[model samples]
Target chain A: MYKIESKEVSLYYGDHLALKNISLQMKANTVTALIGPSGCGKSTYLRLLNRMNDLIENVKIEGTVLIDNKDIYARGIKIDDLRKKVGMVFQKPNPFPKTIFENVAYGLRVNGISNKSYIEERVIRSLQNSALWEEVKDKLNKSAFELSGGQQQRLCIARALAIEPSIILMDEPASALDPISTAKIEELIYELKDKYTIVIVTHNMQQAARVSDRTAFFYIGELIEYNDTKEIFTNPQNQRTQNYITGRFG
Target chain B: MKKIFSRLLNHLITVLLYISGSITSLIVILIVFFLFSEGIGLFGKKPTEDGFIMAVNKSNTVNHLNAEQIKLLFDGEITNWSEFGGKNDSIILFRMDNITDYFTEEQIGENFENLPACISKVVDSIPGIVAFVGKHYIDKNFAGKELQVDKITVGDFMFGKLWFPTAHPVAVFGALPLLLGTFWVSIFAILFALPLGLATAIYIAEVAHPTVRNILKPVIELLAGIPSVVYGFFGLVVVVPFIQNAFNLPVGETAFAGSIILGIMALPTIITISEDAIRTTPRSMKEASLALGANHWQTIFRVILPYSSSGITAGAILGIGRAIGETMAVLMVTGNAAVIPHTLLAPVRTIPATIAAELGEASQGGLHYQSLFILGCVLFIITMIVNLAVEFISRRNRRVAS
Candidate 1:
């Protein structure tokens, strides 16, 4: 069974159709990268998995979104519970105006895990998983704003991991950071796929080639192609995908 | 040539602007100088021409008595002339009135027609006689000598508990009661307004539907635009009667009535400022909280409210400044009793109300007039401090946000 599936999903913002009928599935413990040019509905497709699109006004979704073979869009499903099982990081590093330790520990506290030792352990382990533990362990009480832009993004990743969700969604998570920080995040994503099903949206074609095992290219609200990263990069089955990857045309 | 003309015009405009700005600054400086110069004069000793003079029989050894001795002697607390290095004779007090224990209206004639003659006769007949009369009533040819009075002191003006601005011997300038009343009403007004204003702000900013917010915002702003006297009239007609009927008091006007009116007046300011603060929180921050599996209420309390805490505090301080400087509504509803109120139900007078009520009746260049200016100075300082506090808090919030 697939770990996550979107069966013929379509979405609309007011009268403007943002995403067309799209079907995709991901196996357990695999990294999937969605790549496209700007306003191509790649980020919108990623947001559909965790229902983050619900926060926007005039949003309409049609079709089934399932995780662990259960329909997330079905009635009687709690949105908060669905969100707890699928953690998301934004394009920008938006940390709460709080200390670094508190930023990481917020998810656990909100989930009603009151044990002090458990929260402390989870925060530290999540920091270590994001490779930010050694740099921040000595000053966890300092404000999250004191960190550089790259460190703040990694801290946000650590915040997502503290909840221990089975699926993690990243929307251009490293697009705002420098090259060195982008490589660090790519390396961290490579390690994270061993335990969590990771889906990342990227604008950089090279980034999708470096970090993803499977790749899907979307164009004008339609999924143009999906295949193994090596196959899509080496041998193209679609003309548009070839044109995009070769930097000929978006 | 046109370019040169435009440049010359620009220079002339600059000069005009400078002159206008300097004129405004100069006027402000001159007002401050005038207010301080006149206000500070209240603390010094100056002989006022309108006070009562104490006259003796000329044989009495006491030539001058201090303010306290005069007060005590007139209050009937001192009955023996021997207390002041005089002959050990029984003291006979004389006052300008229709009837007294020492003399009757018949003996002094109807309407006290021969008041000056009667006073001269009384002083010449009794060696220990001490008479109190207006300075204009004292006859210079009589066999009595006028005793010199001492000047009023700053300590007496500030700390004296009584507030009778038209009292005999001297008009008391004691300001403790008015100051306390101002603070008392303002504190109660804040206590009444803060919770209501903050809740309305949160609802409008976070919980209300868009259509509801659009309607509610303008209605609240309309509350601010209503004239203060209209509020005073509402307080007098509605709130005053309601309080009196509910508590069964003899009079309808009380400090509680004033607090209710001022609280209503301050709500718009508090609500508008706090709502703006809450709405300015970045959308991404809110999304981050919600996406972390936190509910909307949790996100508001944990993230939105904490981020906007300084703005809310500034709003509250500004509300308090509005309540403290309010005059006409307080003057109309607080019963205008110049006494230190011991309870919310008691009649009281605030400083602004006192200045507004009595400044008209106060004689120009007199002690009462100068004291009113001093009250204005106190109000200016209080408002300035509150505004500075608001500036400090908002600046600190900006730094933290950055």
Candidate 2:
């Protein structure tokens, strides 16, 4: 069974239709990269998985988004619980103005997990999983703002992981970082898929080829193609997919 | 040629700008200088060319009297000389108006041109009389003796508990009660306004629908634009009577009434500033909080409020500054009783109210007039400190944000 599925989901921001009827399915423990040029609605599509679009005003959605065979958009599905199951990292490294330890611990605390020992154990495990523990462990009580951009991004990932979300959505998570940091994030993403289902939105084709198990190409408001990353990179599926992969046009 | 013309125009503009800036600075310096020069006189003995003095017949036993005693004598609370350590005679009151009553119209002249002479004649003739008139009218050649008056000291002006500036013999310039009242009303005002203002700001910035925000924003601004006198009238008609009935006080005019009125007056400032600060919190930060599965209230409390804490503090400080300096509404509602208030229910007077109420009648260049200016100086310093604190807090906020 698919771990996550969106069936003919359409999204409208006020009168402007941002996403057309786009259907996709993802298995557990796989990395799927949503690749497209700017303003192609890839980020908007990613946000819809966890209902982050609900934050915007006058947003309308049609059809269903299912996680673990249960429709998230259906009545009686609490949004906070859905969000706990689907974590997100933003385009920029946005850390809360708090201690590094507290930034990671925030998720567990907010979820009403009161066992301090359990929280401390989870925070350490999440930081180690994000590969930021060794660098930040010495200054766990220090402010998250004092970290380098790459470290801050890792801390954000650690924050997402601390909640133990089943699905992680990353929206250009390394776009604001240096190339070294981007590489680290890419490496971490490769390691992350063994434990979590990951969807990453990126404009970089090479990054998609280097990390994703499957690559989904989005154009305008439609998903043009979805196939094995190797096939999409080396072989032809659709003309638009080939063109975008080969840098013919956006 | 065009290049030279443009360069010359640029230089002229720069020069003009410098001149305008200097002129504003110069004017501010001059005003501050003038205020300090005149106000400093209140702290110590300063010779005056002429001031109103209490004089009596040479035979009167009272050698000197303090301001409170003189006030009692004039107010009819003290009717005899024995009440004020004087001869056992009836304390006859003489004023400029009674000059005509004492002498014939022909002797006094049509316009009271002989008023000084008539005053001297009355003082010399009436043994029990105490006369209050301008010092120039106290003829040295006449038998009426000018009672030596005590000068108001800075210690008395700053620390004295009573504020009776109109008291005779020597007007008391004590500002402590006014100071306490000002702070008392302002503290209550801040306590009343801060939470309401902050909550309204958060609602407008985070929770309110667009239509609700648009309507409420202008309504709050309109509240600020209403004349202070109108607010005073509202306080007098509404809040004062309510407090009186609720607390079973004899009079409605109390510090609480002034606080309510001032709190209402300070709301717009606090709301507008705090809302702007909350709105300026980065969209990405809020999104990050929400994306972390934190609910809306959690995001607002844990993230948005902390991030905008400095701005909110600055807003509260600005509100407090407004409350402290407010005059007309406080004067109208605070009962203007120049005594130290022990509770919110008591009638009180603030420094600004005292200055506003008496500056008109304080006789320019007199100690009372100078003392009012000193009150203004105190108010200026208080506001300056508050503003400086606001600047420091915002700067620190910026540093943390960066």
Candidate 3:
């Protein structure tokens, strides 16, 4: 089933064109990696999925972004509820100052879920799915800041998962972490494909190659290539994609 | 040679700075030493039995009377000079003011034996009156006039409801109510200022934009630089009447008025310090909370406020110190009444105000004068406790933060 689709979408920050016309479809139970150099609109495109750009004043966008065949930016749509369904992990681990358990339970609390047992179960399950349960279960009540960088990143993932979002967006999630933590994140992304549709933005070509079934390459705010990961990496139709894959120039 | 000369010049500058600093410190230490030397003398055990005594000077007249004859004359028992079998004369009442330049300690004869001789002569010469004499002069006799009384009673000394220090039994001040009133007014001033000041700080720190903050911050800080007497005048004219009319009271010069004025005056110090602290909260922490879906208010309450609480508390303590040490504003608005104020609406007196009002008229070594020194000691102790508390709490907070 189609989880999210954007058609002829363009994004602008005031007078500057941040994203050119683009069309894309994301399927359920699949991981799509969006790869580009810095300032090439990958993060902006990812933010568009949940309307994170709405936070910026004077941001303008054309065309429609649909989730499950429903236009997300349609009149009467609530941004809070949209955010509840579309979870996002930022470039850096941004955990609240609260304890790990409370951080995981924040979305649920905001949504007015008060059942302690259910919240506890969800929190544990999310941490387990994020592969952070064993490492942090002993110190769940400690402040999230007490954790290492990698542990904090996993804790943030667990926080997103605790809310049971169907579409998970990862924007350079492993960029701020070490190699071992990056591999762990890659493995977790592979594991999450069965339960959630995932879109990841990355500058690491190897990370994209290892974790995603399909890859989309962007350059200068325009989609340069979109195809199967193997095809795009091994036999690209575009000369820019080949140059980028072969490490000629960004 | 040039380098050596420049080095010598630098050394000279450093030496001069060091010497100046040392001299300043020495002057402060010497002033404290002097106050202690003069003040503690009153507490030392004197050989005389009485706390203080007064007698009439006998150099001006000859009165061949025994101690009983003089005692009877001063008791309002004998009204005329004939009671002492003297000429038919009305008893001459010789007080210190009526005496010669002896009060100024001018050289007398060949011996400057009695300083303040006029004070001594007034004490020794009265036939139908009483006067003041120093404790050191009790044994010195000139022309057969002797010091009459030993100790002044505590009741007659203080709260005789009268304050005539030149009288036979001078009023010794018992400062129970005045001390209590001082504490009450200071505490109320702190109470009035703390919340409003802290709230203003938070708004300036967290909520205001840069332009608004820049404008408001200096305005508030400028409030501190305004002369305190101006605040006193404003309080007397505006706050006093406002409080009076609001409460429908007979007069507006009450402790509440004093506290309100002091509280307003203290706001700049408290708000400036606390706002600076709040503004220093790390932007990373704020972003972290915001990214976790907490709004501005929640982030402020949960993160920024807790981190800045120590600074806010320090500012409050500073404001308390300011309020306790305030003189003019409180004196003008507090009605300067040395009574135990039972309610906020009643008139009150604080230590600084009492000292300012009473010190000029108080005789140098009288009990009332000493009482003001004791009040000074009390103010010093109160400020010391507040400083110590701020230090202790700030240390504890630093430990927890680390």
Best by DockQ: 1
lDDT of 1 at A118: 94
TM-score winner: 1
Q: Summarize candidate 1's per-residue lDDT along A66-166 as a digit string, tens digits.
A: 89999999999998888888999999999999999999999888888889999999999999999999999999999999998889999999998999889
DockQ of 2: 0.60
* Candidate 3 structure quality by residue, lDDT tens digits, A22-101: 89888888999999878999889998998878767789999899999999889998766777788888778877667999
Deviating ranges (above 4 Å) for candidate 1? B1-20, B46-160
Off by over 4 Å in 2: B1-15, B46-156
Q: Looking at model 1, give its docking quality level.
A: medium
lDDT of 2 by residue, B309-376 (tens): 99999999999999998999999999999889999999999989988998899889877788899998
Chain B TM-score of model 1, please? 0.80
lDDT of 1 by residue, B12-85 (tens): 99999999999999998898888777777777653334556778898888887655566667677888889877
Q: Per-candidate DockQ versus the true complex?
A: 0.65, 0.60, 0.14
Best-to-worst order by lDDT is 2, 1, 3
Local accuracy of candidate 2 as per-residue lDDT tens digits, A1-250: 9999999999999999899999999999999999988898999999999998888889999988899999999999999999899999999899999899999998888888989999999999999999999998899999999999999999999999999999999999888999999999999999999999999999888999999999899999999998899988999589988888889897
